[model samples]
Target: MTTLAPTEPLPRFAVFGAGAVGSYYGAMLARAGVPVVLIGRPAHVQAMRAHGLRLQTADFDERIAVHADTDAAAVAGADVVLVCVKSGDTEAAGAALHPHLGPQTAVLSLQNGVDNAERLARVLGRPVVPVVVYVAAGLEGPGHVRHHGRGDLVLAPFPQAARVQAALARAGVPTTVSDAVPQALWTKLVVNCAFNALSAITARPYGWLWAQAGVPEMLRQVVRECVAVAAADGIALDAAALDADVERIAHSMATQMSSTARDLLRGHPTEVDHLNGHVVARAHAHGLQAPVNHALQTLVHLLEQGRGA
Candidate 1:
């Protein structure tokens, strides 16, 4: 962990896949005087180019001026690259970035799923730090992002982690570099396995889903299955702690929809394959069963198929 001195200049940042999560973090960094370039869809890039990014949150609503582009080449000179693409696109994103990354460039995975960093590393042939993102956010429209609640990161310890943490901290994003990132990531995976699919299938928010009959027990079973899968994968996770976290999310972001739910609403593909589906796959690999997670994954896939019809 290399600490950034007060006199040292902030690193130039490139946010790949600048959707809701990317835009929110990039806006925060840009607002704090850090140089940020957001790579995203044409509509979002065009809108930001025309009139900056509109960031709406409970604390404040403001337009943040940041560089936005649709080209991967925009990442050429970035010192730090935040990979925010979905898990399915991790390798593609890494390959796209390979040609442009400098020798000292640090890539960080801000996407969900436990294996993203490893996948990206395989593609880039470089060390990619895994980051656990805990934020509820959504894109209201082109160039506009609405933050529901919480904006913090837990990063796997790496050479650049401290510098990245300092930069983000200056931007008002709480960051921690931990040695137990594998366990932390597994914990988050368990929570995602519990809620994301259920919320997406029901098209309801966390609080509403948690309020339904048998929903809490259902969530617990999902967590249990995920924990067993994690144990099989050699990552020890506390089931009780994960359960409490699931409950906390229901209350804390009561009105917030999961990213999967938002994706389904927009007719975009959800990351169910990476969440519950991943758990099921890993469970099978370990000669174990994750029935609850498998059921959720199957239901979400059915919903996706129905929507496509």
Candidate 2:
């Protein structure tokens, strides 16, 4: 196994949301005896403060000792900060955490979108590492986070990444450091941009969504447009593998509704803008047309408007 150089004192880590992804990672680190603080909402923070973080997965359910705070002060003096907020809150999150970033602190965007790290870095005027998180998990309740499957990170290379990467791996979260991280990011982006909105808009599981009489054809079109945008952005990808990945999701998580779907159902804003909307914007910049992604974005926005009504 490739391992990162160890850092002494095991850096103080902060997670911006104690939601599903954030809680899982934070719980692992805390279990491994690394100091981890989770900054999140009042209910989660209160529950965690009283009983630590409750984590549920295929193998176990236990309360891990994680410092949970509703206060942004949870980020103070941290050596590594993982931005796990929803994509829409990226800018505000950066601003709120800016005062807490130490000179040597490393910020990593561990969210869904490909552009979050760049966006957050620009807002905070700090280098932010982009990580593609391949995990399917979510909050089961206020203080409880449930993991379904797949927990791995492919992080963009950064100066202090070796130390951070190894720590994460040691805490039971697998980490892969890659020079081709952008390719990985864009690939995930393509998959999400293609499927998430449709799943959310229809409020159907992947299997049901694609299994619709003509939905598979529409999905193929969406994937083609995303591939075109990726190519225009100079990203090399395995077309077959990408298609296979989409098929795998429909098969493996057939009963699963997307996070976007759950969010919209719960009346929370979805990250359609950063997902499909991102492909549209990037394609425009590259002088390529991404009609499929554009249409997907528009449909999701319409759904959002309907929900707002």
TM-score of each: 0.96, 0.95
For model 1, residues 1-309, the per-residue Cα lDDT tens digits are 345787898989999999999999999999999999999999999999999999999999999999999999999999899999989889899989999999999999999999999999999999999999989888889999999889999988877777788889889899888888888888888888888998898989899999999999999999888888888889988889889999998998788678888888878898999999999999999999989898899999898898881
Candidate number of the best TM-score = 1
What's the lDDT of the predicted structure labeled candidate 1?
0.91
Clashes of 1: 0
Residue-level lDDT tens digits of model 2 in 1-309: 646545566778999966788888998899888888999999998988888888888989999877888878779989899989999999999999988889899999998888888899999997999999998888988888999998999988888877787788788888888998889898888788767998988898898987889777777777888888888878877777777888888888899888888888888899998988988998899888888788888888888888982
lDDT of each: 0.91, 0.86
- Cα deviation at 121, candidate 1, in Å, is 0.6
Candidate 1 ranges with C-alpha deviation above 4 Å:
1-3
The per-residue C-alpha lDDT of model 1 at residue 179 equals 87
